[model samples]
Target: MGGPGGWWRRKSTPAKVETYTRWSFHFIALSEPTVIGVTAFGHLEARAALLVMVPVAAHVALAMVTASRALDWTVGRRAQPLRLLWALGAATALVATAAVVLGRHGPGGPGEDTGTVLGSVFGATLCYGVGLTALGLKDRRRVVLLVTGFGAGAGLVARAAGMPALAALGTSAFVTAASGFFAATSAFSIWLLNTVYVLDEARETRARLAVAEERLRFGRDLHDVMGRNLAVIALKSELAVQLARRERPEAVEQMIEVQRIAQESQREVREVVRGYRRADLEAELHGARGVLRAAGIDCEVSGETDGLPAEVQSALGWVVREATTNVLRHGDAKKCTVTVLRPEGRVVLTVRNDGATAPHGSSRTGGTGLAGLRERLSAVGGTLDAGEAGDGEFRLVAEVPLTARPALEVAS
Candidate 1:
């Protein structure tokens, strides 16, 4: 929770807030009677009611104040402190427990001080156990104990006070149900806190990683764009410089052409990053068709590919791009087939091409072709297979999951 104002705000969606609100109401309903016990059943006389309600109310008010203060400090204006709501909840449970056990008495004849103390003890102990159960619900180690304590406490109190059998049964049932609900609710609450922490960490980590990756990619693009061209430009510039010494006109003109290609390459790299360079499947396939034809390779690509997950389709498109690149650039293949299949349970993409000009460069394609494809496929939780699928053929296949982890990050 961020604060009173921001405790309601959410990062991923508004639905988590809605769910949290529901859980809060459920918890308050289920445990309020335990906290404000005699008000519901008229099970206690006035003095007994006073004894139990006072301490319970005090504990709750203090816990809320502590939680609110910590939330304000941590989220309103400053970094998280070493504030301990878990300890505060634990302490409340302890004090309530002590208040309860010390005041224990048995049901007795009316007008007996002993009976008053005993009622206080029964109601407070029941509520205290329930309170502790509610408090440490998010703390996994203590939750089991608190839940067990609630159930056992209800049964013990019922037996001690000679409550009616139905009353005792009702108490046990209520405690059991409450224990399960709170345990689940608390688990979900703790998970929400952890997920928020993780998302912050993930953002920071991705920032650093994205910077590093972008830097590396920029360097690669620059080399691809300007490496040989820069060398040519530098040689021509030297020629122009030397020609200036000789007062020659043509050397300087050649230098101007060199400058033009370098400028165009720079503009293209910028465009690529800005998404001006479209790499759609149809255009890729249309290009591939021509390239394969020039290489004397017959290509059979089938089906209208639709409803494909973006990552999967992108990966498959990449397979087609790289395979076609390999065929035109390196392979002496005679034929290629790019098949796209969407069967009931899985999607499949296969690219098969005839063997290389040489026997096999797949033994060496691992340097960039196969290795990069594997990495891309793995990122989408898919696999890539590259090999001579049969005699004198090279193939690559990518398969990916359609859906995973159904989007409920922190519902409570």
Candidate 2:
């Protein structure tokens, strides 16, 4: 359990964006009904307003469901909502027809106030329905055609219901503009959500590529170190065998040379492996900054790696690497700061990041990654402490005495 706010905090950036976009569509759909209800009540008597409200509310509800299903289809979460779209279209036409009838023959016999209120009902219901209906369409040109057709239809329908030519034209214009606006907004939201998912995937890919590149480099180094030495050892051993078969005295010297070369190869291989495993403190700091910035996180690094013992630097370099990895893997961090300082014969390294949430938990308290880091630090007599730092921040601190030596290796 990640506490009270766990559910939302645990969602990744893409999930959060999707949730926000979906709810925003629902809220927009709800507004159509809210506005119509309020306008009717203000302009008409209670009985007439109630009459207008019922069909309009039903139309809005259908539009909302259609929009939800359409979004699900757009994101590949569900099949195309063809039936729901057809149902909403039919409901919108029926509601608009009813509003036009009410306006022409109202309670006070077709007065201006009654006509005004019902006309708004007619236009709003038609426009919102057009917008939600457009969501099921993927082609931009098709959406444009749909909105244009509805605008022209609104005018023809109003004219047939005995509205003046100018008022009908005005209704057509209103539906066109409003419907197009809502449709464009919905399209943009879907695009933005997809882009967020793509960018997150690219970030993960870049991290994997970095690891693969390092492995290739290590492999190349190992081949270069061992290839020539192994060839020399094989040649000398064959030469010694041939000399001994001929009863030559130099066979002993030849075998001694082979042994010496074999021992030398062993020593060279150890050095190559050691150099590959060693992490330079300066290089790690620069790398951390680059990697974090590439992921769109603002990273600030302060202090120096100069004048530090090699063993101390190696241990802290690993701390920096592990800390940087954790920042990328967990949390929706925006800014990360790393600092190194020396005071009173002790070297200290600290990494801190903001946008920490409770659900992801601290990387320090549990995980094999951090446990391995703790073991590395212990070898150099260093200590690591990590936890929340208040105001939505997580911090990790590592400290080592300057005079600390590497732990002695145990003989196998």
Candidate 3:
């Protein structure tokens, strides 16, 4: 649980009301006894009054705080608020300690009863709502569970031990245990809802943006191809026009040049529009060898790329990009290795970086820029995987069947 809205997320009204009701019930039942009793127990002239106030105040306080966290968690605005927690915690402690001190040392008049100071200290938690809110803001799940559990438990225990009011109103031990259980469940629900919503939102947003950005990029590429090719074709056609006005042989040659450029431009434009960029495995390996050497990482290539399809080559080439990016982002990595191999009609590419980086998906940096690889490879009936292969080694692997022509032969 974290932040005002991050603790529990249900932006809708019905959902908001539902979560609020549960938390309110859990909090009131668990806390009311202690919250009111703590202050009333020592201060109340009648022992009966002390018992009633303790449970009532506790219940109300618990319900209020729980409801607050539930609503805040639902809003998708989770954050850790350490200062707020510290401030509220200090204030709660001060109140509790003061109650205890007053109980022991205060001057007593006739009909006055000095209750145990510890009760005041324990009851002081009624004020912990502020810090609990802060902890919820920070999404400190475990701490809230522990604190709530203890507070609810102690209140019930005190109630059963016997209050002066015929022992009628105090909650039983079983009720106390139940309150603790409910408190924990409430906290977990908040954390779960927030995490699920956040992840789902992130995935959908990434999908939309990825498609849009790719379209824009491919659009620009198409324009570039068309512009350059059309310009060359136009220049050649003008030359031919001038020649056609004179001797015939030169005009025919100029027309041939125009045909070549126009054809080439058309081919390039089609490829760009189709989002097809064939990579020659042989060339990539050759390039990788030099690039890795310059970057001071070992690179090895030993596969015969001659018969492999272009899709496989493109997939493998992407592996190189993702691996290099991981290396650049993780500076602690000292060495990197890229290996290409082919056997049994399958092409495999592996890139490994040695460092102290966590496994893939475990780090935020890995989440972005790598998701597309999964769908991209799957569309072509292949797969890409990234994770830690061993100690100090982060590895990315790509294997896809050959489908398109090799980059060297795209034109031929």
List, residue by residue over 159-227, the lDDT tens digit for candidate 1: 555656786677666655665565555456545655765777788899999889666545543443343
> Could you estimate the TM-score for every candidate?
0.46, 0.61, 0.36
Candidate 3 structure lDDT: 0.53
Lowest lDDT block of 10, candidate 3: 403-412
lDDT of 2 at 246: 97
Which wins on lDDT, candidate 1 or candidate 2? 2
- lDDT, candidate 2, residue 204? 93
lDDT minimum window of 10 residues, candidate 1: 403-412
Give the runs in model 3 whose Cα sits over 4 Å from its true position: 1-62, 73-176, 216-248, 252-412
CA-lDDT, candidates in order: 0.55, 0.79, 0.53
lDDT of 1 at 247: 85
Model 3: per-residue lDDT, tens digit, 1-412?
4678764563554456546645654554455455555556556656656544553454345435545544454554454444444444454444444444444443551123445434434353433343233324434555555455445544444443333332322322332344345445555666665666677778889999988977755654454345434544565677688779876678887688778767866786677766575545565566556544534556565656666665666555545654554454454666766777775666777777776774454352355445545544665677777777767677777887655333322211
Error of 1 at 136 (Å): 4.0
188-254, model 2: which lDDT tens digit per residue? 8877877988999999999999789656545544544444445455656777888899999888987
Q: For candidate 2, what is the total of clashing residue pairs?
A: 0
In model 2, pairs of residues that clash are none
* Candidate 1 deviant stretches above 4 angstroms: 1-52, 62-141, 153-177, 196-218, 238-253, 259-412
Give the clash total for candidate 1.
Answer: 2
